[model samples]
Target: MATTRKQHSEQSAPGPVAAFARFVGCGGGVGVASSFAVAGLASWIPWALANALVTAVSTLLATELHARFTFGAGRHATWRQHVQSAGSAAAAYAVTCLAMVVLQQLVATPGAVLEQVVYLSASALTGIARFAVLRLVVFARSRTQATAPAPAVRPVRAAAPAGPAELCPAA
Candidate 1:
Protein backbone atom coordinates (compact mmCIF):
# COMPACT_ATOMS: atom_id res chain seq x y z
CA MET A 1 0.00 0.00 0.00
CA ALA A 2 1.26 3.51 -0.79
CA THR A 3 1.68 6.04 2.00
CA THR A 4 -0.09 9.36 1.71
CA ARG A 5 1.80 12.66 2.01
CA LYS A 6 0.09 13.45 5.26
CA GLN A 7 1.10 10.12 6.77
CA HIS A 8 4.72 10.62 5.68
CA SER A 9 4.86 14.09 7.15
CA GLU A 10 3.30 13.02 10.40
CA GLN A 11 5.67 10.07 10.77
CA SER A 12 8.74 12.23 10.17
CA ALA A 13 7.78 15.05 12.44
CA PRO A 14 8.21 15.02 16.22
CA GLY A 15 5.55 16.71 18.33
CA PRO A 16 6.69 19.90 20.07
CA VAL A 17 4.85 19.19 23.32
CA ALA A 18 6.31 15.70 23.74
CA ALA A 19 9.80 16.97 22.97
CA PHE A 20 9.52 19.72 25.56
CA ALA A 21 8.33 17.29 28.20
CA ARG A 22 11.21 14.91 27.52
CA PHE A 23 13.66 17.79 27.68
CA VAL A 24 12.37 18.91 31.05
CA GLY A 25 12.36 15.40 32.46
CA CYS A 26 15.89 14.68 31.23
CA GLY A 27 17.18 18.05 32.42
CA GLY A 28 15.74 17.51 35.87
CA GLY A 29 17.51 14.18 36.14
CA VAL A 30 20.79 15.72 35.03
CA GLY A 31 20.34 18.57 37.47
CA VAL A 32 19.85 16.23 40.38
CA ALA A 33 22.97 14.27 39.47
CA SER A 34 25.05 17.43 39.00
CA SER A 35 23.91 18.88 42.29
CA PHE A 36 24.82 15.71 44.11
CA ALA A 37 28.22 15.64 42.43
CA VAL A 38 28.91 19.27 43.23
CA ALA A 39 27.82 18.98 46.81
CA GLY A 40 29.93 15.90 47.40
CA LEU A 41 33.03 16.81 45.38
CA ALA A 42 33.31 20.58 45.25
CA SER A 43 35.81 20.70 48.10
CA TRP A 44 38.11 18.20 46.40
CA ILE A 45 38.38 19.95 43.04
CA PRO A 46 38.68 23.48 41.73
CA TRP A 47 35.31 25.11 41.17
CA ALA A 48 35.80 25.65 37.43
CA LEU A 49 37.06 22.11 36.79
CA ALA A 50 34.31 20.57 38.88
CA ASN A 51 31.65 22.52 37.07
CA ALA A 52 33.07 21.57 33.66
CA LEU A 53 33.18 17.90 34.57
CA VAL A 54 29.65 17.90 35.85
CA THR A 55 28.37 19.76 32.80
CA ALA A 56 30.10 17.37 30.41
CA VAL A 57 28.66 14.28 32.06
CA SER A 58 25.22 15.80 32.37
CA THR A 59 25.28 16.81 28.71
CA LEU A 60 25.99 13.23 27.66
CA LEU A 61 23.06 11.94 29.68
CA ALA A 62 20.79 14.69 28.39
CA THR A 63 21.85 14.07 24.79
CA GLU A 64 21.03 10.37 25.05
CA LEU A 65 17.64 11.15 26.55
CA HIS A 66 16.97 13.68 23.80
CA ALA A 67 17.93 11.21 21.10
CA ARG A 68 15.86 8.38 22.50
CA PHE A 69 12.76 10.29 23.56
CA THR A 70 12.67 13.62 21.69
CA PHE A 71 14.02 12.48 18.33
CA GLY A 72 12.54 8.98 18.64
CA ALA A 73 14.21 5.55 18.48
CA GLY A 74 14.71 5.10 14.73
CA ARG A 75 16.27 8.50 14.20
CA HIS A 76 19.93 8.26 15.18
CA ALA A 77 21.75 11.56 15.33
CA THR A 78 25.44 11.79 14.41
CA TRP A 79 28.09 12.75 16.93
CA ARG A 80 28.62 16.03 15.13
CA GLN A 81 24.91 16.77 15.28
CA HIS A 82 24.91 16.02 18.97
CA VAL A 83 27.97 18.19 19.48
CA GLN A 84 26.54 21.10 17.54
CA SER A 85 23.29 21.04 19.50
CA ALA A 86 24.98 20.51 22.84
CA GLY A 87 27.59 23.14 22.09
CA SER A 88 24.92 25.76 21.54
CA ALA A 89 23.37 24.77 24.86
CA ALA A 90 26.74 24.81 26.61
CA ALA A 91 27.48 28.27 25.27
CA ALA A 92 24.22 29.52 26.72
CA TYR A 93 25.06 27.88 30.03
CA ALA A 94 28.48 29.50 30.07
CA VAL A 95 26.96 32.90 29.46
CA THR A 96 24.55 32.38 32.34
CA CYS A 97 27.39 31.44 34.66
CA LEU A 98 29.41 34.47 33.60
CA ALA A 99 26.46 36.74 34.22
CA MET A 100 26.01 35.30 37.70
CA VAL A 101 29.70 35.78 38.45
CA VAL A 102 29.55 39.38 37.32
CA LEU A 103 26.48 39.99 39.39
CA GLN A 104 28.07 38.48 42.47
CA GLN A 105 31.15 40.62 41.97
CA LEU A 106 29.07 43.79 41.71
CA VAL A 107 27.09 42.93 44.82
CA ALA A 108 30.29 42.23 46.79
CA THR A 109 28.74 39.95 49.35
CA PRO A 110 30.89 38.81 52.29
CA GLY A 111 29.28 35.43 53.05
CA ALA A 112 29.38 31.99 51.36
CA VAL A 113 25.57 32.11 51.18
CA LEU A 114 25.72 34.71 48.43
CA GLU A 115 27.99 32.49 46.37
CA GLN A 116 25.61 29.54 46.77
CA VAL A 117 22.70 31.70 45.68
CA VAL A 118 24.56 32.73 42.54
CA TYR A 119 25.37 29.11 41.72
CA LEU A 120 21.75 28.01 42.09
CA SER A 121 20.49 30.84 39.88
CA ALA A 122 23.08 30.07 37.21
CA SER A 123 22.21 26.36 37.31
CA ALA A 124 18.51 27.10 36.78
CA LEU A 125 19.25 29.39 33.86
CA THR A 126 21.52 26.80 32.27
CA GLY A 127 18.82 24.12 32.47
CA ILE A 128 16.24 26.41 30.91
CA ALA A 129 18.53 27.37 28.05
CA ARG A 130 19.50 23.75 27.47
CA PHE A 131 15.84 22.67 27.19
CA ALA A 132 15.02 25.51 24.80
CA VAL A 133 17.90 24.70 22.46
CA LEU A 134 17.19 20.98 22.54
CA ARG A 135 13.55 21.51 21.55
CA LEU A 136 14.27 24.15 18.91
CA VAL A 137 17.30 22.55 17.28
CA VAL A 138 18.31 19.08 18.41
CA PHE A 139 14.96 17.39 18.02
CA ALA A 140 13.53 19.61 15.31
CA ARG A 141 12.87 17.92 11.94
CA SER A 142 14.96 18.95 8.94
CA ARG A 143 13.58 22.01 7.17
CA THR A 144 13.76 20.37 3.76
CA GLN A 145 11.60 17.50 4.90
CA ALA A 146 9.31 19.49 7.15
CA THR A 147 8.44 22.26 4.69
CA ALA A 148 8.83 20.59 1.31
CA PRO A 149 5.66 20.50 -0.76
CA ALA A 150 4.16 17.11 -1.54
CA PRO A 151 4.35 15.82 -5.12
CA ALA A 152 1.32 16.70 -7.18
CA VAL A 153 -0.85 14.00 -8.66
CA ARG A 154 -2.49 14.58 -12.04
CA PRO A 155 -5.93 13.21 -13.05
CA VAL A 156 -5.89 10.25 -15.46
CA ARG A 157 -7.63 10.80 -18.80
CA ALA A 158 -9.03 8.20 -21.23
CA ALA A 159 -6.99 7.72 -24.42
CA ALA A 160 -8.46 9.04 -27.71
CA PRO A 161 -9.52 6.53 -30.39
CA ALA A 162 -6.97 5.84 -33.16
CA GLY A 163 -9.66 6.41 -35.79
CA PRO A 164 -12.95 8.31 -35.82
CA ALA A 165 -16.04 6.31 -34.97
CA GLU A 166 -18.80 5.89 -37.52
CA LEU A 167 -21.73 8.23 -36.92
CA CYS A 168 -25.26 6.72 -36.72
CA PRO A 169 -27.81 8.24 -39.16
CA ALA A 170 -30.85 9.89 -37.55
CA ALA A 171 -34.13 7.97 -38.09
Candidate 2:
Protein backbone atom coordinates (compact mmCIF):
# COMPACT_ATOMS: atom_id res chain seq x y z
CA MET A 1 0.00 0.00 0.00
CA ALA A 2 1.19 3.52 -0.75
CA THR A 3 1.88 5.81 2.20
CA THR A 4 0.82 9.43 2.30
CA ARG A 5 3.44 12.19 2.47
CA LYS A 6 2.30 13.08 5.95
CA GLN A 7 2.68 9.50 7.17
CA HIS A 8 6.13 9.26 5.58
CA SER A 9 7.23 12.47 7.25
CA GLU A 10 6.30 11.14 10.67
CA GLN A 11 8.41 8.05 10.08
CA SER A 12 11.63 9.98 9.38
CA ALA A 13 14.37 9.61 11.97
CA PRO A 14 16.05 12.36 14.01
CA GLY A 15 14.18 15.49 15.03
CA PRO A 16 15.63 18.77 13.68
CA VAL A 17 17.56 19.60 16.82
CA ALA A 18 18.84 16.01 17.11
CA ALA A 19 19.86 15.99 13.47
CA PHE A 20 21.67 19.29 13.83
CA ALA A 21 23.50 18.11 16.92
CA ARG A 22 24.57 14.93 15.15
CA PHE A 23 25.73 16.93 12.15
CA VAL A 24 27.73 19.22 14.40
CA GLY A 25 29.32 16.26 16.16
CA CYS A 26 30.19 14.57 12.89
CA GLY A 27 31.49 17.81 11.38
CA GLY A 28 33.51 18.51 14.48
CA GLY A 29 35.23 15.14 14.21
CA VAL A 30 35.95 15.73 10.52
CA GLY A 31 37.30 19.17 11.31
CA VAL A 32 39.71 17.81 13.87
CA ALA A 33 40.97 15.16 11.50
CA SER A 34 41.21 17.59 8.60
CA SER A 35 43.07 20.12 10.68
CA PHE A 36 45.60 17.50 11.71
CA ALA A 37 46.04 16.41 8.10
CA VAL A 38 46.50 20.00 7.05
CA ALA A 39 49.02 20.61 9.79
CA GLY A 40 50.98 17.53 8.79
CA LEU A 41 51.03 18.57 5.13
CA ALA A 42 51.64 22.28 5.69
CA SER A 43 55.44 21.94 5.98
CA TRP A 44 55.57 20.20 2.60
CA ILE A 45 52.83 22.08 0.71
CA PRO A 46 51.73 25.71 0.71
CA TRP A 47 49.41 26.42 3.63
CA ALA A 48 46.46 27.36 1.46
CA LEU A 49 46.98 24.36 -0.78
CA ALA A 50 47.26 21.98 2.15
CA ASN A 51 44.09 23.38 3.67
CA ALA A 52 42.29 23.10 0.34
CA LEU A 53 43.27 19.46 -0.07
CA VAL A 54 42.31 18.52 3.47
CA THR A 55 39.11 20.48 3.26
CA ALA A 56 38.14 18.65 0.08
CA VAL A 57 38.81 15.27 1.61
CA SER A 58 37.06 16.23 4.82
CA THR A 59 34.00 17.49 2.98
CA LEU A 60 33.62 14.15 1.25
CA LEU A 61 33.95 12.38 4.58
CA ALA A 62 31.39 14.71 6.10
CA THR A 63 28.89 14.06 3.30
CA GLU A 64 28.82 10.36 4.08
CA LEU A 65 28.59 10.96 7.81
CA HIS A 66 25.84 13.53 7.48
CA ALA A 67 23.93 11.26 5.13
CA ARG A 68 24.07 8.29 7.47
CA PHE A 69 24.09 9.87 10.89
CA THR A 70 22.34 13.19 10.42
CA PHE A 71 19.76 12.47 7.75
CA GLY A 72 19.38 8.68 7.69
CA ALA A 73 19.85 8.58 3.91
CA GLY A 74 20.72 4.88 4.05
CA ARG A 75 19.89 3.03 0.82
CA HIS A 76 17.40 5.71 -0.11
CA ALA A 77 20.19 8.06 -1.19
CA THR A 78 19.76 9.06 -4.84
CA TRP A 79 22.02 10.56 -7.48
CA ARG A 80 20.26 13.85 -7.00
CA GLN A 81 21.06 13.70 -3.31
CA HIS A 82 24.68 12.89 -4.16
CA VAL A 83 24.84 15.97 -6.36
CA GLN A 84 23.42 18.10 -3.60
CA SER A 85 25.93 16.60 -1.17
CA ALA A 86 28.77 17.39 -3.57
CA GLY A 87 27.54 20.92 -3.92
CA SER A 88 27.55 21.38 -0.17
CA ALA A 89 31.04 19.90 0.00
CA ALA A 90 32.26 22.29 -2.69
CA ALA A 91 30.81 25.24 -0.84
CA ALA A 92 32.58 24.13 2.31
CA TYR A 93 35.90 23.64 0.51
CA ALA A 94 35.63 27.06 -1.12
CA VAL A 95 34.99 28.74 2.20
CA THR A 96 37.88 26.91 3.85
CA CYS A 97 40.32 27.72 1.06
CA LEU A 98 39.32 31.35 0.98
CA ALA A 99 39.64 31.68 4.73
CA MET A 100 43.10 30.12 4.70
CA VAL A 101 44.24 32.38 1.88
CA VAL A 102 43.01 35.46 3.71
CA LEU A 103 44.56 34.35 6.99
CA GLN A 104 47.90 33.68 5.30
CA GLN A 105 48.00 37.21 3.89
CA LEU A 106 46.86 38.86 7.13
CA VAL A 107 49.74 37.23 8.96
CA ALA A 108 53.13 37.60 7.25
CA THR A 109 53.50 33.80 7.34
CA PRO A 110 51.21 31.71 9.50
CA GLY A 111 52.51 28.69 11.36
CA ALA A 112 50.58 25.44 11.70
CA VAL A 113 48.95 26.69 14.89
CA LEU A 114 47.59 29.87 13.33
CA GLU A 115 46.57 28.04 10.17
CA GLN A 116 44.67 25.43 12.20
CA VAL A 117 42.83 28.16 14.05
CA VAL A 118 41.74 29.72 10.79
CA TYR A 119 40.92 26.38 9.24
CA LEU A 120 38.74 25.35 12.20
CA SER A 121 36.96 28.69 12.21
CA ALA A 122 36.15 28.26 8.55
CA SER A 123 35.02 24.69 9.16
CA ALA A 124 32.66 25.86 11.90
CA LEU A 125 30.92 28.28 9.56
CA THR A 126 30.84 25.75 6.75
CA GLY A 127 29.36 23.15 9.11
CA ILE A 128 26.39 25.40 9.85
CA ALA A 129 25.79 26.08 6.15
CA ARG A 130 26.23 22.44 5.23
CA PHE A 131 23.70 21.42 7.87
CA ALA A 132 21.15 23.80 6.38
CA VAL A 133 21.72 22.67 2.81
CA LEU A 134 21.85 18.98 3.63
CA ARG A 135 18.64 19.17 5.63
CA LEU A 136 16.55 21.43 3.41
CA VAL A 137 17.89 20.36 0.02
CA VAL A 138 20.14 17.28 -0.08
CA PHE A 139 17.80 15.37 2.21
CA ALA A 140 14.51 16.87 1.18
CA ARG A 141 12.84 13.49 1.47
CA SER A 142 13.86 13.36 5.12
CA ARG A 143 12.50 16.85 5.67
CA THR A 144 9.17 15.60 4.39
CA GLN A 145 9.36 12.69 6.79
CA ALA A 146 10.29 15.08 9.56
CA THR A 147 7.28 17.31 9.07
CA ALA A 148 4.63 14.72 8.17
CA PRO A 149 1.86 14.15 10.66
CA ALA A 150 1.83 11.05 12.81
CA PRO A 151 -0.35 8.15 11.72
CA ALA A 152 -3.80 7.94 13.25
CA VAL A 153 -4.27 4.93 15.49
CA ARG A 154 -7.52 2.99 15.27
CA PRO A 155 -9.00 2.09 18.64
CA VAL A 156 -10.09 -1.51 19.10
CA ARG A 157 -13.70 -2.16 20.11
CA ALA A 158 -14.52 -4.39 23.12
CA ALA A 159 -16.71 -7.47 22.70
CA ALA A 160 -20.21 -7.15 24.22
CA PRO A 161 -20.83 -8.94 27.54
CA ALA A 162 -23.30 -11.87 27.60
CA GLY A 163 -26.67 -11.14 29.31
CA PRO A 164 -27.29 -12.73 32.77
CA ALA A 165 -30.53 -14.48 31.51
CA GLU A 166 -28.63 -15.98 28.52
CA LEU A 167 -25.91 -17.28 30.85
CA CYS A 168 -28.49 -18.88 33.22
CA PRO A 169 -30.47 -20.45 30.32
CA ALA A 170 -27.21 -21.91 28.92
CA ALA A 171 -26.75 -23.75 32.23
Best by lDDT: 2
Residues 4-92, model 1: lDDT tens digits = 75555435545667656766676776776776676557689866667778778777777766666554533455586578666965785
Which stretches of candidate 2 lie above 4 Å from their native place? 1-10, 143-171
Q: Report clash pairs, candidate 1.
A: none
TM-score of candidate 1 on Cα atoms, chains taken together: 0.63
Per-model TM-score on C-alpha atoms: 0.63, 0.70
Global fold similarity of model 2 (TM-score)? 0.70
User: What range of 10 consecutive residues in model 2 has the weakest lDDT sum?
Assistant: 70-79
Model 2 per-residue lDDT tens digits across residues 1-171 = 998754543466677899889888888888898889888897799866887787667766777777666775443445677678878777887888889778868999777778778878988898888888888888877557555766899999997898988778854
Best prediction by TM-score: 2
Residue 81, model 2: lDDT of 76
Off by over 4 Å in 1: 1-14, 73-76, 103-117, 142-171
Task: Please give the lDDT score at residue 78 for candidate 1.
Answer: 59
